[model samples]
Target: MPLLFIQRALMIAAVVSGLSACSLRSSPPSFTASGFVADQGVMRVWRIDDGQQRPLVLMSVYSPYSGPGTISTLYEYQNGVLYQIKRTDADGDRDSIQLRFTVNGTVSFMQRQLATQRQKLSNDDIALYQYQARRILEVSDALNVGRVRLLQGHWQQGEVKLCNGEVVKPGFDKQAENWIARRTTNNHQPVSLAWLDGPEGRELLLVANDDFCRWEPTKDTL
Candidate 1:
């Protein structure tokens, strides 16, 4: 009789374990990275490339030890609503307005709805306003750092606008490459701007104060 009782207990235990495993399997996916994990709810994100479909980047945050981690993610469009949800550890709550996904290793940037902003044609206006706007967006997207460090690669000597609206020209000294580009206007002060090499020196990469980042569109639905 003791042997029969033991067998019945083992059978019940197996059934309970199986049910628990099934429950966990049905739960939502968790976004995990080094020293960070984001538990997202009710949002389905997908990854697509070359017509193939997969789960898109679901979670990204700045690493605690390193500089701010930039993660970019793409979401599915359901009924014309952007469904990408961003979760982070900094706020101690999930962020609904801005969501991020990992594209490459430890590098992510802010993406905007291209439909919102007007792509103006004036170089001077772009240099002043547009460049700074993009840079500010990048800073906002960054997780931990209030002011990010700029690593503007050297191109050539040129004139630039400083945060104080002072037009500072780089003389023959190539070592004066370390400077910040102010992104916003204060007391009618002009936002700063910098010029860098672009495409055979015909084009220029404008670096200014604010968050200027690369946002690439996703091509698939998963």
Candidate 2:
């Protein structure tokens, strides 16, 4: 199966397992948006968005063997903030916790395990670390475009170069043309798509440093 398919299956499994246990009189927690909660040494869920009642973040800490160890630290991004759900497994039982905090103007998720229940944090300590999530949408929006190829580089004989510049050898790829165009145009700050001649056919290129014009590519036939 495809990697994405496998990953999705795993995620679904985790979600189902997490919500599996509930008595008839009790209602499972509703997750309005993605968030976290701090349960009784079992698991924690944190919500990053306001006005949402469900868990946007979930953490469970578990150590399954005779010696002390940690399995994984899971992070989920909701409402443009990264939240953490940590699990601690010790002896035969597992203790999990979820937290969302703000530091240095950034949101962070954390989980820690203690040798004993007495080591758990106090209410004041939890309050001190409690905070709202900052916006992470900025980063995603910034990197929306994948990659760029400055100037029109030729892939002739495994060599590449900026248009009107000396040639530099580079790797070749049949599927990389689209990626190259997006990256190059964005980096050059071209308001519109650039055109260029590609290894396969005609294409677009951008040159912001110069005329800020597009480069069109045509296949040369003998």
Candidate 3:
């Protein structure tokens, strides 16, 4: 009877947890050098214009802890509004484009559809959002669907407009390289991510490990 009870309990657990017995043995992915735990993927955020250090994304590897454990996410901002987000977890990955948001608020895995219009460039030609949401919609759509992380091997490089309206190329630095190496050696960090320079010069940074980060420029900066 005890043997039957144990088997039944295990089966019940699999259903309740939405995981199979075979899957339980599989470990979640994690980064050792960049410190991205498959269970603790997150986005780190900072207002480059402000002196305050705000870690919004847990995935940055440098980002302070936040959001649901095991959820990986990225963020992008336009005019201080966090309108776009991409995230992943045990269930899978998803993108959320919000038309509305609360002040300094965050979201889970819900997604929003972009209202676009087919523009007539010529009698025989048409394009998406030639007029509608042109300023940001196109830019948002052009971004990569998903960025694995700092140690995923494929590092991404690009221009990021800081909160101060200053455009800078953000990617690997000597400090990060050394930091990652040391962490890997000590087994304190495991994930891989790119270290980017912020608009404030070499002293500051915009980490691109977890995903995209939002740069909230102040009124004057805009």
Candidate 4:
């Protein structure tokens, strides 16, 4: 499938991700907007707009949505600060993004993961990957966030310059855990990395990075 279509699918999935707490990780000891349980670990979910809740005990949480190489999101609070993180996977690649907001909803920090995955084909000795590079921006007075593409190319020829100005070369930094940007073409065009340790396991991070860098987007033909 075209990479664009897959990316669009992920973007849409993120918006709809704010599902009823009951549906995701369906049965947690506490699945409130303030916090929830995941795989025996407790992750505090802070409401971007307000703050109110009680201490939660750890419990087992069951995940209902399981799509290999799909997109998902997680919210957390630290030191009374609210943050949002999103993860997107494609083919065999996984990625994510983290956004920390102020009490009144001002963005304080942003970190995004730009990644690709290579999986060995059952019928062939070679492997292939699908790259889905996207942007997650702080919106609505930083009370919420939205996702859009910065650059996306698949196959072995995929390449993009992340929001941080780091370039994910066609096949640079290829490794088992994830791929990294080792080179840049600066093709008069630009685009978008990060890894995250989740409660269940480690997942790659996705979204925008307006914190460490300031590489803006430009129109380009893929």
Reference-based lDDT, each prediction: 0.27, 0.31, 0.29, 0.29
Instruction: Tell me the tens digit of each residue's lDDT in model 4 across 9-49.
Output: 44434543443223453322222222222222222122222
Question: In model 4, what is the error at residue 97, expressed in angstroms?
Answer: 1.1
lDDT of 2 by residue, 98-188 (tens): 5654533233544444555534555554444332111112211111111111234333333454345557544434455555544555363
Off by over 4 Å in 3: 1-68, 72-88, 91-178, 186-191, 202-222
Best by TM-score: 4
Stretches of candidate 4 exceeding 4 Å from the true structure: 1-67, 78-81, 86-91, 116-222
Model 2 lowest lDDT segment of ten: 139-148
Per lDDT, the best of the predicted structures is 2
TM-score of 3: 0.22
lDDT of 3: 0.29
Quote the positional error of residue 187 for candidate 2 in Å.
57
The worst-scoring run of ten residues by lDDT in candidate 1 lies at: 34-43
After TM-score superposition, the amount by which residue 203's alpha carbon in candidate 3 deviates from its true location, in angstroms, is 7.7
Between candidates 2 and 4, name the one with more favorable lDDT. Answer: 2
lDDT tens per residue, model 3, 120-210: 2231211111122222222111111111112122222334443334454545457755644443563432233333221222321222334
